[model samples]
Target: MSYELQAVIGAEAVLRKVAAQQPGAVVVPLRQGFALIPMTDELFDSATDGGRGDGLRFSKLPGGFERVLADWSTAGPLGYVEAGYAGGVGTQRAALWADGDLAIGPMFVDVNEPFPAIGSPISQVLAHLGATRRRRDPDEFVAVGLDRCRDTEAWLAVDRSVLPEVARSRR
Candidate 1:
């Protein structure tokens, strides 16, 4: 099976567990498995969605693949739309900026393959926890290895914890 399909399946199981942990959240099915967003806003409009890019409703999936971050078997890059689709996916994967800004996906472009940990936006965050060195830090200063953070192919699940409660609030 395609890695994307595997991602979807994997996402389904994980998000379902997340739903149990996160009150008000439920697993909403997509073409493949499912994504987790609040259950009440299942029919939300894509145009006005602010949580992610245009939001993360499965209902907003483009009929045909528009120019998106990456191409994969059946499953696609599922992340905040504006950030993932705007111009470039930027250095950050899902960062929230002060100017009402948010970055989008490092979509599960390939689940079977390991992510490029050296210069990815996620690598930048790892630097902040004081748990590791910046990717740019001298090779000798590489505080901690990225094996724990990197080495995953799937785009991360929609982690609402990163955003404020208002961001997750229904529109």
Candidate 2:
């Protein structure tokens, strides 16, 4: 099964707010950063159905901007997970992921305005998925070149260094 994760960046003001709120979380400047979401085909399909498809959610940490980073999986058909903002409201964004050691996927430009928030519902979803909150150091995020997904077989190219860059550029 194949799954796609998206990191959306909206207005610069919103991006700045996100950075300020979660200084330690990954933050890339508008038109300069990306968001990495990982999932399987089954999970992705379920999310489209308004169900708890994958049992994972990306959440922002309390007292700062670090998102509770982790993975979530479930055994039920109705169980699912959510990542990113709720009701969408800010920043220009991009999505990235890896295939073994290669990065391949879509790099959307001029994303939708008023993107979702990284807090609230996303946090609740993460907890439901049993994800453990781990502080992702700002230096840990990196940057990489992303290509558009041509077909289902395409994989997003990513490097370990890219993770930290995603957070650093926001500052």
Candidate 3:
């Protein structure tokens, strides 16, 4: 099946700060201490200067968004990752923010191409965020259980009972 995902992945603590700032943001816990906030149309419209579209230009994402991620780095690194696949071919982009700065990358990877020695863009961010690969796991994506869902919308189906809080304060 084809896969697609676009979201911000970070430690639950760090994402809580994001949720606080972007009302209606949901913090869906993953394996380990990490969690993800599915980037919705509303969030994109509110955060970007370029208006919503297919690509993410961090410069267009506004200084306020970066300021929140910067301020919460003590909790952990945060990354925005987008991936899309069809018929086994896909593209992925990822950027890591830690210690109030861009740490790893806003790197892009062609999933059907030979991956960099380090791994795919998302795996690099996941590795930086402390995800470890298990014997049967192909990469951090699967190791963190991201492979369980083909898209962010499906991932958002996570049981709310596990989340410490889900921001529903926005319209």
Best by lDDT: 3
In model 1, residue pairs whose N, Cα or C atoms come closer than 3 Å (at least 3 residues apart or on different chains), thus clashing, are 53-80, 53-81, 108-155
Error of 2 at 146 (Å): 16
lDDT to native, each model: 0.28, 0.27, 0.73
- Which lDDT tens digits does candidate 3 get at residues 4-64? 8888898777797768877557887777667888876566566655543234443224335
Q: For every model in order, what is the number of clashing pairs?
A: 3, 47, 0
Ten-residue region with minimum lDDT total, candidate 3: 162-171
- TM-score each candidate: 0.22, 0.22, 0.80
lDDT of 1 by residue, 1-171 (tens): 111111111134444553453333444432223232322333233222343323332323332212221222123222221112113222223221112222333233221344355534333322322233435654211333212112122223334244332233222
Q: On residues 41-96, what C-alpha lDDT tens digit does candidate 2 reach at each position?
A: 43234234444313222321111111111111111101112223224432222222
- Where model 1 places Cα greater than 4 Å from the true spot, the runs are 1-10, 39-171
Q: After superposition, how far is residue 64 of candidate 1 from its true place, in Å?
A: 35
lDDT of 2 at 127: 29
How does residue 171 of candidate 1 score in lDDT? 28
Poorest 10 consecutive residues by lDDT, candidate 1:
1-10
Segments of candidate 2 deviating more than 4 angstroms: 1-88, 91-119, 134-155, 159-171
